[model samples]
Target: MSTTTALPHWDMTVVYPGLDSSEFAQGLSQVLQHIDELASFFAEKQVQALPAAPVLDDAFVRDFEQVVARYNAMSDEVRTISVYISSFVNTNSQDDLAQAKYSELQRGLTLLAQQATRFTAWIGSLDVEALIERSQVARDHAFPLRKAYKQARHLMSPVEEELASELNVSSGSAWTKLHGNISSQLNVPLKIDGETKSYPMSAIRNMAFSEERDLRRLAYEAELAAWKSNAVPLAAALNSIKNEVNVISRRRQWESPLEASLFDSSIDRETLDAMLSAARASFPDWRRYLRTKARLLGLEKLAWYDLFAPVARESKVWEFAEASNFIIEQFGSYSQRLSDYAARAFRERWIDAEPRPGKRDGAYCASLRADESRILANFKPAFAGMSTLAHELGHGYHNLNMLKRTALQRRHPMTLAETASIFCETIIRHAALGQVEPSEQIAILEASLQGSCQVVVDITSRFLFEQNVFEKRQRRELSVDELNELMLDSQRQTYGAGLDEAMLHPYMWAVKGHYYNTGRSYYNYPYMFGLLFGLGLYARYQQQPEEFKQSYDDLLSSTGMASAAELAQRFGIDIRSESFWRSSLDITRQDIDLFEQLAAQR
Candidate 1:
């Protein structure tokens, strides 16, 4: 087997030289000055008449436009600093300076939020329709303005909102940061080749994809032990974050935490229900796939840790360069624009793919601004790692499509956020299936099916777990043992008899970062939405290979501006219908059948 490949470190020169650089200092100063200026403008006597304006006249429009432009400018600068610092921290989570800058940035953002709330409240009090029709600037910002007006109902007084934001920096966000630091510092002890060695959680977790079953099991046990060691503090962090969300959400007059999440997702309850119901109906098929995987591994029942264990004995490893070239080639086969954008990302060093100590776990693509995005991944040479690279590159492709839009218009909801990345992943996976030998085909098929199961099956479990947490958390703080039981119950409900009951992962809440975010509740369902939605789009692309290219780009570009239902309608997809979701699941069903046949032959 090849040793761990040397991964690429992203170039931060585009934002600044470093945290200590003069450029960074100047940028920070400029951002602070901009914030103060905006705050003063909001406090001006002239702005006092904003809410009482009876007519949408030229003067009113001009003043509003100026405020909007300044706000956007301030936001742009803050976002640039936020992205750079966040990228640095993602790769070096233990850096005290980065953490300090992050906290400072949060405070700066709170000040901006105060100004923005006052401004938005004034705008919301206006005749928005007339403003949009009369002013071209308002017309350009119609969607965001309209959304702000709708969301204004939930906004507290500016003072209260500002206080909440500031308090979160020390309370909710502080707890989250503590959780991250603890998780990053953890060392999982595994006995490899008769010698006990300690590995970081991220490194050890990757061993789940190893072909060696013993290694996968050992790593899994060690990871569980590590989590167990920190369970008490992690549980406190989870409870505190969720409780903060509950308090603030109630103060905002949201019907429920889940309702607020749905509003934020730009998806309706009916659509979410339809999609989740479809997923539940498909659990039988998912279980069949799992059972097949267990049989191939010579186990009567698969454990939770065994879920990611490789079924293909002939899995091949791709070097970092090989994976990059392959991803570029696969993207080119679909669209030259996507291919070119990915090539630029590679050439410009926009990706940080190295696996090292102090780096945050998992992969993500951060949109620094409209024209730039930074991708971070812990790249290994295995097929799974290659797929992860493709996934993040897909996110870059989505950002590229939205580059021409305004900053506010480029903010897509979480439901539509996963579309491009998952679509890109499907593209490469199918392409691989066409080229690989039969045994290798099993590896590719297993990898693809395993990914679908995560989105469809595992995400459902997470969604259920979070739902239970919120329901129980409202009554009282849950103990560590109670949280574990809730997690195990959710898994059983979602995974059914597919997994061994004895070996389930109970500390999942401790490891998953998604649950810790107070701002974004119920972050699980979006993966299911993205996968099914992307597959539905991919099915259309397969049907009309040439014509669907533009439609795909159009969909990606519109994601930031339209609702998920509206975007689906452009391609004649009815997301609220169960049939649409089932069609996507049918693709997974076919893959499972193929896997079963291959396993029988083997």
Candidate 2:
């Protein structure tokens, strides 16, 4: 628990001096004006209500290019400030100004949503291939255009879509806000030094990684109690968000909410099915790893609190500076560009790594302008800490590679989004395992296995839980108790004999922010997708390091332009094949075998 040193706060000043600054105000004003003008542009160009097969003359082609180009340009302007406000809101949950500004910004997004619906609806009737040939902008945006057209099948009328968009600000978005505010501000009671003290949820969560078993147990109990206390609103938020998704999903003529998510993910149902099948088959292996970990901890079965309890033979505390250097050096082994990008991110203070009360939990990198990204992390001093840095910097590097593309072109789906990050994480893990001493080897290998299990096993539980919630929510609102039961059931199904069933986490539905997001469903599976997909790609990179670099960069850059299957094809990997996924799983299976051998030695 050597987390005394202060982690660096990112350089937000570079984005904008402050919320009240002239530039910030101008950004807000500019977006408002652009949306208004965009609406006018839609109206003037007859962008709404196009004929089933509109005459694609030269004039129409020229006008359509402007429409798509303008929309993309406007999106960049909108995202620049949108991420700025979010960075503040996410970092400081109590930042009233940032919250207010974000709400205000959503209004403009609502109007933009209306315009986008109209545009999407209009594109539905067009000959996408014909238009792609005629307009350069159309060619550049062919993937998004085709996607919008395909999505048009599920959309309501422009009027209905607009109404839904407007209501989202108060319904989905507001409920999500409530969950975040409550979760971040939540202070759970924990006993320390004979005095009961209240710690913010983030601090309590970080303690999960702490080596102290008693402390971890206490934090787990306190966290569950806190969530139970707040479960009413959190459950309401979950219900409302899910119900909204169900309503809209049905309205859009989607067969299921999962189908809509599959669409949004730019991945097909077959691909997901393949991945999950492989994942389910590997569950026993993961359970074996868990059992071995339990044995190492001198227990028969692990409690939920012990899942992330660091298992290291020779433990090392990775301070912020040390972790940063380690990440940089490992990244350099892959590519100097990646190494340099990570170095610059650290040098320029592009990360806010401090774990504090107001700051939210987890780590994510938000692409601000062009290639610049701001990463938020609650950095704990361990192998996981350094790996977290590498993971986020991988995201930053992904953004850097896509710099030549427009904002719309860079808008990749969640399934593709995690690949680069996990790829970087693998780099750090693999490099560290090879170089560390036998004692540290146990530490690094276990840490790596711990992370893989999370993505594979824990994520499977979350996906199952979300599925049941969605299925039941379609009938009626679920009670808090019902949600807990569903969560426990999913955990039981996934973890099986690996964990003490009585000690499983039931409030995981409330703990994860993934479930609270109304815009996306099935956020859990994407991590699994990323982990396996990334492992597969990394394997290729190792065999043909020289040839793989450019091809790999191409795949990352083209993520937004193609489906997951299509991208996988470029690498000669069939995402829809269970064998492909099984191959990826086998990579982790080897590690699990190694871990069991090491555990036997211990």
What TM-score against the true fold does each predicted structure earn?
0.97, 0.98
Ten-residue stretch with the least lDDT total in model 1 = 45-54
Q: What is candidate 1's lDDT per residue for 447-476, written digit by digit as tens? A: 889999999999999999999998888999
* Candidate of highest lDDT: 2
Q: Which residue ranges in model 1 land beyond 4 Å of their true spot? A: 1-5, 45-54
Query: In candidate 2, how many Å is residue 365 off?
Result: 0.7
Q: After superposition, how far is residue 33 of candidate 2 from its true place, in Å?
A: 1.8
Model 1's alpha-carbon lDDT is 0.86
lDDT (0-100) at residue 298 of candidate 1?
93
Residue 140 C-alpha lDDT in model 1: 81
